[model samples]
Target: MKLAAPIALALSLAASGPRDAETRAWWATTATLSNDAMEGRDTGSPGYDRAARVVAARFAAAGLTPLGAAGGWFQTVPMAERAVTAADLRVGASPLAFLHDYTVNPVGLPARLDAPLAYRGYCGAAALGDVRGRLVICHATRKPGLPGDADRAAALRAGGAAGMIAIADPGFTVEPPRWPFAYARSVRLATQPAPAGGLPQLTLNADALGALIAGSGQDAARLIADGSAGRPLPAFDPPARLTARFAFAERSLASPNILALLPGTDPALADQAIVLTAHLDGYGRGEPVNGDGLYNGTLDDAAYVALLIRLAERRAGRGFRRPVIFAAVTGEEKGLLGSAWLVAHPPVPLGRIAADINLDQLRPIFPLTLLTVHALDDTTLGDDARAVAAAMGVQVQNDPEPERGLLRRSDHWNFLKAGVPAVNFVFGYRPGTQSERIYRQWYRTGYHKPQDDLAQRIDWKAAADFNRFFFALVARVADQDRRPAWKPGSTLAPK
Candidate 1:
């Protein structure tokens, strides 16, 4: 007989481990890996490389055999880098110069494009004038070195433009500084094709636009004020010319899943493995934000990775006899790339893995007031998480931003997709309120902003508390030797 997906996952995870005392050890292991010097652990960066090395070393010290195929622990993740040069533009066979017509300021990403552009102004409020299926251009009213502008290009791509360029200066060419917490300028193509579209998008720099009307050699700000749609500029003296070159890199990084074997005294149960996972990478910042260059992300996640490390040390040589996998995956910030890759290629068989204990952004130092389970009330998993929270005197709630798709956002997504029993632990809001202020505030302030550096206001004790609470939760599941599963008829399959 075949078992249902959720049940199968529950059965496997239920038999993995039964360790409760090593929670602080787990915290220490993760904290050492999240040092501020790691620079928000940007994937492929020197700091990120250092962080990966540190994790491998710690896994070795913890008596966990390297699951990586190579003799050494490190699995080099291949990557490439390219610098941007000048950009060009052409409209109806007429050339548009870089400073004269188009602009580009996007995070590093690979592309095979030089598509047409459409002038989709303020999300298509202005007439595109046969500018579809091409590189689209739009205008931004915000200053250059501000936050929130990544979506400008994405909208264009979604609107059927092959690519997008956000022009901060409506007409001028002053080189503006990068914005902190800015939106992703790149666009994901929507399925709906453009209906007889034109060129791609071009967004002008709003702050430095006034200086553009006087032709070359003008302040960037002057262009924004003068280039009003109501007003017109002098015809091109010698006709404008446009040319731009964008380069980005990506590669196969053979990332490993950290594993430790506790070796159960009972021979039958020793075969199963429990998984405790957390993603190591965050969207790194290349531009300066609040006078900081790197996105340190001390509180956002480093704190939690620290929690896992501490817990691992706490449980060394004790805990249950079953094996445990302490997996710190990479590229989670980039759409859970590492975890997805691992699930497709697990060192252990997919069926032999038991429940997953996930710590996303643990912060329980000050007062243990609230806790959130991504799959709360969805199955026995919620009940298990709730029981743990209740015993610890912490309030529990279901994910507040289910609509935002947080349930399927991180490394845990891979485990869930593989039909492995998994759960993501996080704190989303105040105990009594449903507002997602915590997540939204983090997003606006440091989700990917350079301001994520470790500062005085960070509550370090929170990470410690998360370690203890997680220790208890893991024990509740592992010690019992029972699996929790998603409810039947649940539509919660990984997308």
Candidate 2:
């Protein structure tokens, strides 16, 4: 739904008694958590453990009961850390550096792989003719009828390819460094572990792709021009065998998912719960940009964690029919590890979770006039969110960029997969507006960078408005007699 009109920018600074106090408390908490001392609050790090203690303390002060294991505020999630110590891809005599020229996703790679290369133009079902036992080199295609990355990967694996190397489409615009961010070191669930010798996958930047074409009897310029013009290029075997090797170690760690409970007032409904969640982890350290190494993650997540704390504070001594669970999960940046663990091994029975309202890296840098609710139409939680947002004078809208598939990108996705209705909130903007400009700019510059620290600008009133709306949304869901459910025909709805 479209907002009736734009909210005046002046309302951004208009502050009153208790609201002003809430805003101040929110900022104060954000500053402390986003401080440099936190070391970006990376999952499985000492800094993250400290952040967990802080969350536990806050939850206690808010009069919430610890619902984690051992009656403590920490749910231990088993995770395995994998970092690429050395990775090299050689085409004939030309060798490519790991991060500078190409990078492999550590999640599905083996310790070493040596195979002949075959180019499957789009990795489409028809194009993947006989890639058995070869390293299939595929290009990312934005074609209308072609399959997506996941589909391509599945097809390649089914065709018995040893592995796949995905090269970016030459037509796509590459910002400055050609490839913006470095490959991430990942942490995944120990229970659902990354396949050690699975079909290995690697990605290459379009700009540095000349390395693959060297000595392969392939004209780099012609191939690039053909791909850029969206013309079909014949899939052929480049005259080179690939010897790719990666050195990495698997380390087990316990990441914390802070869980606290606010018991329901009504005895009957108190058995069920409405889960409120926000991830607390950020990229620990990677290739430095502009000489800074730490990713402070203030805007990305520390803000939302603080918002959860403040909402719990506001709900202190309040009454609701169903219990409320505040879950500050870790390893979200790594791939929703903590939330996956939560669903598999919950503080309460999985059947007892009525719904999930997850807060991730939601930007509040502009006026709080519109909200994009992911999975808004899939379940009744969407109705609850719309009603709450409308009551707060904010228009609720569906995901504008469905191609991004944002609903499955965050922690709530795991809960949804477990049959609990879920919704994720994001600041919305029009197609052509200043809000859109600001949103894109923030993502380009600070989304996961060290620049996301408290030094960056924010709309205080917008943050306060969203916090109030979210708190009310939680109360509304918690107080409802019946549990929220997925709408009819939604894939998320159980049979």
Candidate 3:
């Protein structure tokens, strides 16, 4: 005898295993969001609008109430963008290729630039001497006690340099510099102030450093070696002059942030809400990598956004003790603009936001043995994350590589700045382990590249495990009596 259709389907799902079903569901959402038809979901593009509509429909189906602008599902975010349409550069008659040899920062660049070249080692305040009105070249280093990008920029600007050209460090293996930048562009919220008197910056391919230093009686190879090794280097005038012309195209556009809410069941705890956020934007078509131009940002962020949808669906219209906001934000690739706008113009009172459990930078390519928790000591939300991970037999550790500046890279940083306790996670691996190998390989090839598509390999079990952890953690934070708070003496705590 044949079973009824619903009963047979349920039996099939049970036999196929719950984890299998969940993985398929999660991947289905991720695939849809990152597919070619979505056109990479560039912020303010039609593709991003389509993706937002899909997310809004999913939220509605999951019984979420629209909590966006004007009682609709989307909060429109106005944006201004600038893109370099054409550029020409010649250093002592050596015409370097745009994107192939170098890419300008494209912010506050003059229409024309003609200046002499000065090799300022590290561009530190002490190393830079009489660089006024010259284009200063510096070695980009991440070593301890060395001047970083910000410090270098400040010193060059204060020293009255016309521009700054930094050689991309070749020795930083953690995140090796990838040549052939797609393009140079900058985007900001329309209401935000434009950068004032910013120095024009350029990043020269390390391999192209010789072109800039040729005929100066200095060995480019030796300088690179010493710079990469953090050794002392001589500063002198390179026998070259830079002449460049740039043309830019500017436009204004708007994208929507998909917002939904699940109200609390308990009146006492309902005033405090837990905010869950993930960005919905990805790098659109740009310079082709291996003949593929589309950057399907699957694990980079689309997958985490999918995880948010899965959590909403799993709730099945049930309310927790405290309300929860599901915010699929936009413009994270454009410097966290959407989350910033949301925090500034909140649907609910900013004070009601007790904590943020952000979903980004999570790659479950290997077994979920260890997790790196960002801001692990800054707030009580870290305690909730720790308890959730520990219950699943996963070890939690503080971010081991703070030099990457990941703490300020994602949407959670905006919430954290607003004094809402926030936490984010990364799949961790021990040194020299297979997990480390896979993790690093992904960064080199898949991170922000066209290769980060659905075709990439995924550990289904690990994905399911993270999804479970996220669900449990949200429940723990939403149902607990005490709202999440900043730990005393935490530097990130709001003054």
Scored by TM-score, the top model is 3
> Over 4 Å off in model 3, which ranges?
1-19
- The digit string of per-residue lDDT tens for model 2 on 138-204 reads 7775556666788888899899999888876646432112334545476678777466666788877
Off-target runs (Cα >4 Å) in candidate 1 are 1-31, 70-130, 133-257, 283-285, 363-367, 431-440, 493-495
RMSD of each: 12.0, 6.1, 4.8
By TM-score, the candidates rank as 3, 2, 1
Which of 1 and 3 is ahead in TM-score? 3
Model 3 over residues 232-277: C-alpha lDDT tens digits? Answer: 9899998889999999999998998999999999999877999999
lDDT tens per residue, model 1, 149-266 = 4555444544555555555532322223233323233221122132243233444435423222234454434333543332322212121223344443323333333444444444
Candidate 1, residue 495: the lDDT equals 34
By descending lDDT, how would the candidates be arranged? 3, 2, 1
When summed lDDT is taken over every stretch of 10 residues in candidate 1, the lowest stretch is: 186-195
Per-candidate clash tally = 101, 0, 0
Q: Scored by Cα lDDT, where does model 3 land?
A: 0.88
- Report lDDT (Cα) of residue 470, candidate 2: 85
Q: What is the Cα-based lDDT of residue 152 in candidate 2?
A: 84
The stretch of ten residues in a row with the least summed lDDT in candidate 3 is 1-10
